[model samples]
Target: MTSIGIYGSLGRMGQAIIEVAPSLGARVAGGADAQDDPAPIAAKADVLVDFSAASALDAHLAAARAAGTPIVIGTTGLSAKQHEAIDAAAQEIAVLQTGNTSVGVNLLARLVRDAAARLGGDWDVEIVEMHHHHKADAPSGTALMLGEAAASGMGTTLGEARVTDRAGLVGARAEGTIGMASLRGGSVVGDHTVIFAGQGERIELTHRADDRAIFARGAVRAALWLAGQKPGRYTMDSVLGDAVLGA
Candidate 1:
């Protein structure tokens, strides 16, 4: 069984992981919170799952690197600099980082990408996501991930194709661009929908997350898969495997 360590042990996701780990044939090596030192936990576990704040990402990555342990990061709201840090850490220790750990969400991303590729630039892409009111970020990380998938299919980058804010008098929707809208409300676990609009018709792909346990289940599965891998950066798609992608 994999020995799993958790960062942000007190958070909802962390608690969910702890609850589900044993059933998945894993043991909790330990955990660390904001006031706790993660190095010790990192050193002792076969793999580490991070659901902590973005500000603490550097320290957690450092700890994982120092201990030569694989890490699965499910933290959201990461800045470009933090992503750079993750990339750097990946050079040494195996790193699997994703905006959302739900297997359904990753599979949704793949489908979005495939649809974008097949539909071509003639289709306008827009992603709308809703999360719980307590969620702090706008255009939730998973929204951006879906946008990136559509952009990748269209052979453009999200930075170039993404249009997040559109208010009154924004003119017509730009061609070949991906739009993102975020909503916050009461106790919504998560909801994402990708819309593709063309001249005569429209296609929509959606995924709804009803509970946090799904994320925890996926994260543990990712940690188990990552534990045996060599040092490198990975994504949830890799965890789902190429067979699923082909399917």
Candidate 2:
């Protein structure tokens, strides 16, 4: 059986991964928390999964690199510098980092990309997301991921096309810019909806995650798939075949 290491052992997503690994034909070799050194677990396991805080990402990435073990990072709220670090690390060991790991969310990104590409620039793209009150990040990682998809569909980067805030005197929505809004409240697992507004008509696509298990299960599946792959940056689209996605 494949042995997977957990980087945020005490957190909900980590616990969920451990809870569901058995049914997926994998074993949790061990895990580490914020207060512990992750290298020990990294050295022992065949692959590692990180649902840890963004603050702990560098150390975790360093540990995995030293061990030459493939790692899947599910951490969110990362800075641009941290993203640069992931890009640098990908050259040495296989790295798969995603805002959200749920299959539904990833597939939603695909659909959003397709819709945005075909709908033309007249369609105003807006993404909205919500999560539990405990979530540290606004515009959950999943929200940014969707934004990236929409931007890509329109042949642009999110930085150039995103509108994250609006205040007094804000005029009409700019053409070709994608807007984002985030909500936080009681125990919501996750909810994301992408709106495509056009003249006299609108289309909205959405996905709701009711349990943490969906993310954990997808993470495990990604870990298993990354085990034997060559060093490079990978995505959920790599794990979920495009043929299946196209169907």
Candidate 3:
């Protein structure tokens, strides 16, 4: 059986992963929390999954790297420096990182990319997302991920096309720019919708996550796939494959 270690073992996502492990053909070898040392878990498990705070990322990545264990990072709100660290660690061990690790979400990203590419500049692209009230980070990581997909299809990066905040006198929406809006209320698991508005018609693609199990399953799937791969940086798209939409 595939043994996995979890960072942020006390958090909601971490607990969800542990709960869904058996059904996903994996077992929880152990876990590490803010108060605990992650080294033991890193040394014991076949692979590691991090759903912890961005502040703890450095130590977790270091532990995994030292042990030569593959790790899947599901934590959001990471800085560019942290991303660079992940990239550096990928040179020594397999590393998979994502904003939202839901098969459906990953599949949705594929669809958004294709739609943006075909719709051309005439069709304005917008992404809207909402999460639970307690969730932090505006626009959500998933929203940014989808924005990246849309931007990629538009032959640009999210950094160039992303429009997050809008105030009075913001002026007309820039052509070719991808807009993002965020909502937080109640106990919403997750909801993301991408709108493609054109002159004559509009197309909207959406995905709703009712439970955390979907993300847990995807993380497990990534961990399993990472185990056999050579040391490198990987994404859910590669793990699920370009043909995953049909699956």
lDDT per model, in order? 0.94, 0.94, 0.93
Off by over 4 Å in 3: none
Residues 1-247, model 1: lDDT tens digits: 8899999989999999999999999999989999898899999999999998998999999999999999999999999999999999999999999999998899999899999999998899999999999998888989999999999999999999999888889998889899999999999999999999999999999999998999999999999999999999999988888765443
Which stretches of candidate 2 lie above 4 Å from their native place? 243-247
Q: For each candidate, what TM-score against the reference?
A: 0.97, 0.97, 0.97
Residue 145 error, candidate 3, Å: 0.9
Backbone collisions counted per model: 0, 0, 0
C-alpha RMSD of each candidate structure in angstroms: 1.5, 1.3, 1.1
Lowest summed lDDT window (length 10), candidate 1: 238-247
**lDDT of model 3 at residue 41?**
94
- lDDT for model 3 comes to 0.93
* Residue pair clashes in candidate 2: none
lDDT per residue (tens digit) for residues 3-36 in model 2: 9999998999999999999999999999999789
lDDT of 3 by residue, 1-247 (tens): 9999999988988999999989989999989999788899999999999999989999999999999999999999999999999999999999999998998999899899999999899999999999999987787989999999999999999999999889778999999999999999999999999999999899999999999988988898899888888999999987999667765
Show model 1 residue runs off by greater than 4 Å. 243-247
